[model samples]
Target: MKEIRVGLIGFGTVGSGLAEVLLAQQERLEKRSGLRIRLAKVADINISEMPPQFGDVALTNDAADLIGDPEIDIVVELIGGIQPAKTFVMNAIAAGKHVVTANKALLSQEGRDIFAAAARHGVEVGFEASVGGGIPVIKALREGLVANKILSIMGIMNGTANYILTRMTDEGIPFDEVLRDAQQQGFAEADPTYDVEGIDTAHKLAILMTMAYGMNITHNDIATEGISRIEPVDIEFAREFGCRIKLLAISRNHGDHVEARVHATMVPERHLLASISGAFNAIHFTGDMVGNVLLYGLGAGKMPTGSAVAADIVDIARNIATGSVGRVPPLSYLPEEISDRKITPMEELSCPYYFRISAVDKPGVLSAVSGILSQHDISIESVIQKGRKQSGPVSIVMRTHTALESSVSKALAEIDALDVVAAPTVKIRILEEDE
Candidate 1:
């Protein structure tokens, strides 16, 4: 068996798990690939925290040590970020080494340049773990679903956000309380901004849309809204309306344009996406030929994400041994083929909405609210009042008929400005089965 050496950068949580997988499943992977996969070197500044499983593997404080090594056949960049990781990946490719990575942010922002570099060097870049941790979604999109024209992608891509929202909905706790608990339980980072604020989800979605649609979609192209403002009352309303509130990364391929956005979505209970709970991630994408498909699994963690990275290593090893590297482009589209598509503006997004408004318990408050909606060409499907408080405001929940986002925004603006309205109305986009 020809041996292929693999160098890993950043032996952190996912890196440690990769070490564990490589140590424990070395024989099986080599047998499956018909190529010996050797753990040649690990580069991490904090080598003290390296897992005990890495018995005698070489360690270096510098990443270039591995990138420059001519013997290293594959460079797995697990150091998550844009700066040094991007430089290292580019360098490894320039050195004629294949690359595997799990950096969604880097791939979304700088993937065009990185893929261009890989193509120039005739090296493959495998990023199976970038989006869905262990779900193997990238492979499915790049290869499995290659035969079909992808129509849309709807996903709960952020495990931290999903975990927080799941806890909130299940325990009836508030967002802050659940977030704190998630942080303590190691589900969320201390900052929690990227995951909770939908930026992380946007990065993942941009990667997916690029692969699915062959459009060079970047992270900033997706309009994002966080789950920080999700309230227990909205959860109650979701249940009442046979729905569940999930932080969703959604994108659709309209004939001439694409709809890409990340926001808190009201998914119906009957949909497969609604069943995904806890720290789990689920992607529901539609294809022209195959119709709807659902992939569910752990979105992030030690073993799950590492398992994904290791799978990519197996793929790269197979490519190297077969002497057919660069068979698949990084974004599943050749560099010249990835053209810029128009990302649908936020104001034009059309969806049914769930609105929670707090208003003074006055007679014509409903009339005033409806008047604003009518003025903006917004129409209501159903409305229910959740009883009144003694002296202050009462909650009114309304589900609107499908309306343009601009109209809803303008109506909400007019409604919020009314003296009877207590606060800015809470709006959650409803994802219906038809869509």
Candidate 2:
């Protein structure tokens, strides 16, 4: 059997897990893959103390050692960042080595250049772990659903954000309180702007959109909104409407253009997505032939994500063993077929909306608000007034019929500017999914 040597960079949580999988399951992997897969070297900034089980493997601080090594057939990059990770992966590809990575940020931002370089170098890139860690969604999209025309995708891609929202929905906890608790529980990072602000979800969405539509989309192209503005009162109101709020990364293909956005969306309480609570992740895909398919699992962790990385390694190793490199394109589309598609402007999209307006209890407040919405061509579907306050502002919540985003924005601006309006209006999109 041909021996395919593996070199891993970054010895952090995921890297350590990959090492464990590669070392502990060496014989099993060889038997399953029909090739001798070996962990030849590991590179990290700090390698002062090596793990006892990896005594036979070489360790180095310089990543170039792995890229430059003639025997190293695959370079696995577990480091999460843009700088040196991009440089190292590019150099590895330039050296004619197959690459596997879990860096979503880098791939979402710089995938075109990276994939183009790989194509030029005649090596495949495996990045199944980048989007939904260990969920195998990437593989499913590339192979399993390749024959179908993907119509739409809605996913809870960020664990930190999902965890925060799940707790808020279940316990009626406020966003701030839940976020603090998630941080304490190691579910959120100290500086969680990426996860909480929907940036992380957008990154993963970009990757998925690329695979689904064969389009050149990036995180910057996504219209992103966070969950920081969500409150306990909003969750209560959602329950009144028989719904739950989840931070959703949504994309839809419209023939000429595509829609991509990440925001706090109100989904029907009975929907499967609303029930996906806590830190777990779920992605719902709509394809022409498959109709609707869901993939759910742990989005991030040591063993789960490590398992994804190992699967990629074995796949690439099998390709090497058979001398059939580049059998599957990284994006599941031919390089020539992948091109920039028009992204529909967020303002042009139409959807039903939920609005919470703080207004002083008065005789003409409702009429005035409805008048403004009507003028903007937004019709009210339902309205609720919570409590009565003679002096202070009371919450007036309204659900509107399907309206263009631009019209809603204009109406909200006019309503918020009224003398009776006390605060900026809080708006959330309502997703009407088929059962």
Estimated TM-score for each candidate:
0.97, 0.97
Q: Which candidate has the top score in lDDT?
A: 2
RMSD values, in order shown:
1.3, 1.5
Colliding pairs, model 2:
none
* Global local distance difference test of model 1: 0.90
Candidate 1: residue 91 Cα off by (Å): 1.4
Clashing pairs for model 1 are none
Cα TM-score of candidate 1: 0.97
Q: How far is candidate 1 from the true structure (C-alpha RMSD, Å)?
A: 1.3
Off by over 4 Å in 1: 49-52
- Give one digit per residue, the lDDT tens place, for model 1 in 1-435: 999899999988998888889888999997799888889899999865455666668888999998998889999999888998999999998999989999999999999888989889999999989999999999999988988999999999999999988888888999999988888999999999999999999999999999888887899999999999899999999999999899999998897999999999999999888889999999988999999999999999999998999999998888888887878876777778889899999999888999999999979988889888888888899999977648789998999989999888888988999999998899999998876
Model 1 residue 95 lDDT? 94
Residue lDDT tens for model 2, 311-381: 99999999888889999898999999999999999999899999999998889999999999999999899
